[model samples]
Target chain A: MSNIALEVRDLVKSFSLDGATINAVDQVSFQVRSGEFVALVGPSGSGKTTMLSILAALLTPTSGQVLIDGQDLARMNEKQRVKLRREKIGFTFQSNNLIPFLSARENVEFMLRLNGRLDHASRIRSDELLARLGLSDRLHNLPAQMSGGQQQRVAIARALIHNPAVVLADEPTASLDTERANQVVETFANLIHENGRAGIIVTHDLRMCQYVDRVLQMQDGKLVRTYENKKEIRELARGSIH
Target chain B: MKNFFLASYLAIKEVIRNRGRFLLVALVIALITLLVLFIAALGEGLANGNRQYVANLDAQLIVFLEKSDFSISSSRLETNTVKSVRRVDGVADAGAIYTSSTEIVSLPEPLKVSMLGAEPGRPGMPPVIAGREFRGGEAREAVMDRNVALRTDIEIGDVIQIRSTQGTEDEFFDLEVVGLVEGQSYFFQPTIFVPPATWEIIRPQSQSELTSDTPYPNIIAVKLADPLQTETMSARLVDEISNIEVANIETTINNIPGYSAQQGTVQTQGFFTLLIGILVIGGFFQIQILQKVPQIGVLKAIGSSNGVVGLSAVIQIIVVTMIGVGIGGGLTYLFSLGFPPTIPLVFNGSRSLIAVILLLVIGPLGGMVSIIYAVRIEPLKALRLG
Candidate 1:
């Protein structure tokens, strides 16, 4: 397979409110190659979540196309799109949306179950994934029984356990402390590189950008700047850019 | 099949985690099932009480007076009509019987009884279970129903005094019980079978009709040569005889006074009980779905199809309902054991099965709204991220 895991083409999304059209995502494009972790930084109402939703194939764009693993999202029927979402895409919301009734290991294995590939080997992988995220002792605890940091790590494990082509996380560290957030992001990056899967994280904290391969900044629903150089990315992570 | 198993697994897990809440709802369903089953039992008991005697009549056709409007109590045919009915084609045997309700003097407080007089070994007489049948030329002799013997101290060879309200003054007759027949109650009273001639003398008669001396029967029981030809034989009898109406055994039983209305009331109550069950189950599941909105959203976000979610809900309903129904059936059986035989409660296997099946079906029917609600829960809004 080619290394280019995701390709976007002038993606635009608009919402009509009270007889006015607002461009939530303007004509913008980016590509994510395999084994690369990218961070999307934006202010409130900058359309980061909307762009992430489109990339995950949870929402259809008004124009342009999102191609994941060489398959166009818009061209597939609802059934095919649902199958693609289950098989090729993994995502986590800001709240660490874990199934409250399922234990930590069950929650991670749930992704494999959705893809109809859950087996003895996959069960072992789920346990290994959680253990790598520093949740080895809390595998059998429910989401309600775990701390916020622990739950977020379990969510990360769930996202990667199914081995999807693209993994998306929206503010996954919002509920964790500064130190734990750093550990989670660093572990997330290592997992992405090890598995050779493309990963994208949307967050407001530039300090988290140090773990990512590149940083894409958005302003007014447009990709205004990019920090690809190691020097620039490190400066942004140090809070040195006012 | 995999989806079904997964759905069931999820449903069972939730129920086990929240067992107290589910148990409360299940208890309510059990009580409703108990009440409905009791109502059905009462309906069967009351029907059996009213129609038991006529239903067991060996004759296929019951000939009534044309002017009585199909009412067995008011139909009166003279003795000559019996001879004419026996001569009709396709008639195997015809029997004359007279019936009256009167008080027994042997009991302290006016024990009412339905007195039926028929020729021994005829189609109208009930089979004797305990003692001997009537011999030839037996007079002032009677056979008491088995329930009467069991309920009272009366036995074979006991002389019973009956007080008749016929004529200007009351007449007393000493009749000896010679036999006992089982399940022969009529009109909610234990019946006593006597000779036709003796019954005519003791039957209530107005002063004007007392001196006529014409033997009259309330109805005629006609046995057809081929019982399957009930319709054609009945039509032929009505054509050959004048001033007579004919009905089959089922029609005759249905025409009993208050029988139809009693059964109708119980059936209506049973139907309303089922409706209430549906409403209760639907309301509970709707509340459950509303409370589990976020959980449902998470499942959907992880790629659970609507079919999976809906099937899980249905499985939950079915499991809960079966548990409740099983408990109710057991409780009903236990409760029925303590009731005395005099009470009119009866539990039949087939009718109870029908009621249980109806309850089981209603559980899913009631949960349909909740299933739709679960499947329609949008993940974006439920997670509050939209």
Candidate 2:
């Protein structure tokens, strides 16, 4: 029922490596209404990932205000921020990033356990999420036992299992083959359309841009353009957008 | 919290993935702990045996007779005072002995000895290895330690000259070897025994006139029907035994100059060695925690809290250290068995237990420091690196 799941204004982040200051993200501002699926498209090293990190509450912008459902993240303390993050944000990395020692089910259930909320519903949800992701047959399989695509699905299941309001994914299909990438993109689209979650997918592959409802293109630490439709993005691919 | 548990599970997985490093650290910590413990345990076990051996000889208590606050010159108790102490209430048999240092010459070289003079009815020293026993009133007879007696001419009726100093011509005497004793000296030098009457002739009198006290002998050996009455007997000696000192053997030998003080020094050194062990563990784990920064970044980026990621490393460190130190300490105890009692190595349980606990704490405390640094590793930066 919230107006926006995530809102950022005048975000600026720079890093001083050795003695020179390099601006990684500069004055980037955006908002995601509930159930919005946004794709961040940028050239390599164009600060797309930095913008996504700031949105996920993982990175503190050197100067800016990030608000989730009207709560300002810049003002929240560490415990409050962690609580907000755990309850609100989900992340899917490009690398299948599954815990190598844990079984697929355990990886899903671990989020519930980490919350220290052991309920029948959480357990049921973990099982249901794995099955929903077509991983019911590979429930007990570790990351090594599963293929890259299977691992990516498990990672998605982990992200959504906690039922967070916002899901921030960084190149969720980078390690997958073409088919797996499409499947993962479809899942992200479903997460917004079917589950009413705000999802941000940062990717270089324009193929995934079709799954997102909106697309933002970046160039040199700035959002140079935005597109209101993913189908438009897929149909019009001349490396220029407005 | 869910994020925390998930991250923790993941960290442990990552930690174990680098088994070669973790195992090596664990093994080194355990082995070092074991080695120190082995030395310590052996020392303590042997010391316990020595203490027990000394206790069984029936020394009720001990007393110190100082030549001065600064010096430990020899002093004698008047013979008449011995007769008076014999008359005290619960009065039992009491005799005199002289303790001294002298030298013994065998095949390889001349060895220094801590000597004790025996009188009648005073329980003769126990034999563990054995040469022979001292007989009464023998003028020219002495006893050597049994351990080395077989290899030398320290046999019965063999003459061995005992000198008070390396170059001193003033104090020397030849005596027929009478007996040998076993398990006598681990902390002490190899022992030689002579008769109390012979000691009366051979003991060095102080040049200071104040020390020329009337006495039976300086050291009195007592046998009581009731050991519980030591306090009463001690009091009686103060008042009743005129011009004679009746003190126990326990306090006298142990209270010798630099004796008790040296024990404190050894214990302190042992304590710091344990601290060094702890620091080594802490240092190794600190470096390990630093190396896992990227993993922590991944967890944090996934919405894991600092508490979960930091404490996971701590728990991991504690588990590894306890396993390592436990095995090390156990092996140390086992290794101690081969050490002889005369090795001057003592394994003190209280000291070692203190060391083990101290060593154990280093892991977690060091983990805490490392965790603080680990938490500072930006999750965003970590993600970028990944």
Docking class of 1: acceptable
lDDT (10s digit) by residue, model 2, range B238-353: 66654444455455445445555665655565667666766777788778766666556766766677777766777678777887887787777676677665465555567577
lDDT of model 1 at residue B246?
94
TM-score for chain B in model 2: 0.68
- In terms of DockQ, which candidate is strongest? 1
Q: Could you estimate the TM-score for every candidate? A: 0.90, 0.72
Best by lDDT: 1
- Model 1: fraction of the reference interface contacts it also forms: 0.25
Going through the candidates in order, their DockQ values are 0.45, 0.29
lDDT of 1 at B362: 83
Looking at model 1 chain A, which ten-residue stretch has the lowest summed lDDT?
A78-87
Candidate 2 lDDT for residue B243: 43
Least lDDT summed over 10 consecutive residues: which range in candidate 1 chain B?
B132-141
Per-residue error for B147 in candidate 1, Å, reads: 4.0
- Docking quality tier of candidate 2? acceptable
